[model samples]
Target: MSRPHVATIKEMAKFHTDSRYLEHLHKISQDGDNDDPQSGDFGLGYDCPVVEGIYDYATAVGGATLTAPQCLLDKRGEVAIDWSGGWHHPYHPVVGTGDLCGTGLGKGTSLWMTQGWVKVNLWMTQGWLGVDPMAGDPMCSFNMTPVRRAQCLQHALCHVLSCCVSVLSFHPVSLCWSY
Candidate 1:
């Protein structure tokens, strides 16, 4: 029997922040460690709201569920999503630093998915956080992925990092795969 279609959604949440979500910001400051002016150590844990919100949106749009470590692939059609696939510097919540610092995890994963077969549309933030586009060794987002044949198209939208750069790219199901 043929395997069922699967999709993945991944987001590189920002670090050096006071709190995870805006709602808890005030609460975190109230009783937690506000020592660091840059980023307070609020000993509280909250769900990554953006990531959760994206999952909800994907489900509503007909995307399949995915595990944190699993990769979603579409050999037939298109997928939809809100944010994810940016692959910047991030702590694994516990382990070593995750794909952050602009290492091109998005491109890496895309290459793994298409196995070098499809094209990629890269959507990035603007201004201080904006990607040089013309810079970066790979240059092309699609080419950044493991899939050599993958082509990349840059989509530098307004207010990208302000929300989630992943949101700019409309791909249902966060693709997760082994590096």
Candidate 2:
């Protein structure tokens, strides 16, 4: 397994934010104070905390998530592993509505499922924050059982992190996102 190119701070910013957020992050990093009064306006100090070196952390995570798609786009591999997958949910996209998943045409990841996840189990493994029967509420997700829970969590992670693609057709041959 080779490492893909790490995305530049500029690139990550282009995809997710602009200069304002980056500037705020740098200011927080320098002062080591994440308790800015207007932090909520910047979407920080909420679910995402404003930590020291948050700029670096955010870039690293973005790079890691971009790795799988980069590898596929570069034709470096058919299967790319991105442990950072499944956590960052996009604002809006398609999935459950697509005919590919519900028509029993092919298996898919819950990454695209916005709602009604509890209804679909045949095409994909029960997955993500609320979809997995074992995984409970979004705020405090994951199971309570001991050994079996661990195994199940691991299984779900594997499904989340790995994306398999058919080189011939360029489709997701497995539970993964392909370029």
Candidate 3:
């Protein structure tokens, strides 16, 4: 809605998706040939056809998925929503499923958490333990590290964004807030 923030090629590459695959998709979308028998390629024929804006379409969809979380992280909104997201499938990473970069979300969140961005309620903190009481919870019992908890939260947030209207409040480090 806000002029549509789009993720650049480099940003998407952080997910470790094969860059060549992305490039090929772009090429096929343009005047380049997708079904080149000379190279023994059969990727873009049916099911995944080589349309006019294939590359832009993929990046736009992927962009929506990435941007919503960013809005929350930037403190721009308590909850960010991307209706187009929830289920992402990029064939370059894997066949059919396209979720090899699934680890990308966790990796990104963990990085932010280390920088004191994401909230770590399940982790064993020096002071406030947040919602999860240190009574008999598995997160505290195992003494999970902040990074691990951040990674777990990262995965959970992915589902949360996709799920219909779930309210979760994550606080930045030092600046605490209600959940």
The digit string of per-residue lDDT tens for model 2 on 61-177 reads 667657766675677754555554443434222343323434332444333433433454432232322222232323434443334544544545454333322111111212122
- All candidates' TM-scores? 0.23, 0.52, 0.44
For model 3, how does the per-residue alpha-carbon lDDT over 37-152 read when each residue is reduced to its tens digit?
A: 52235355554456677678768866876766666556665455554453243434322133432333322222232433255332111111231322233334554444554455
Off by over 4 Å in 2: 86-89, 92-138, 141-179
The TM-score ranking, best first, is 2, 3, 1
Number of clashes in every candidate structure? 22, 1, 0
Best by TM-score: 2
Give the TM-score (vs. native) of candidate 3: 0.44
Query: Worst ten-residue run, lDDT, model 3?
Result: 165-174
Cα deviation at 65, candidate 3, in Å, is: 1.9
Residue 37, model 1: Cα distance from true site in angstroms: 3.1
Candidate 3, clashing residue pairs? Answer: none
TM-score of decoy 2: 0.52
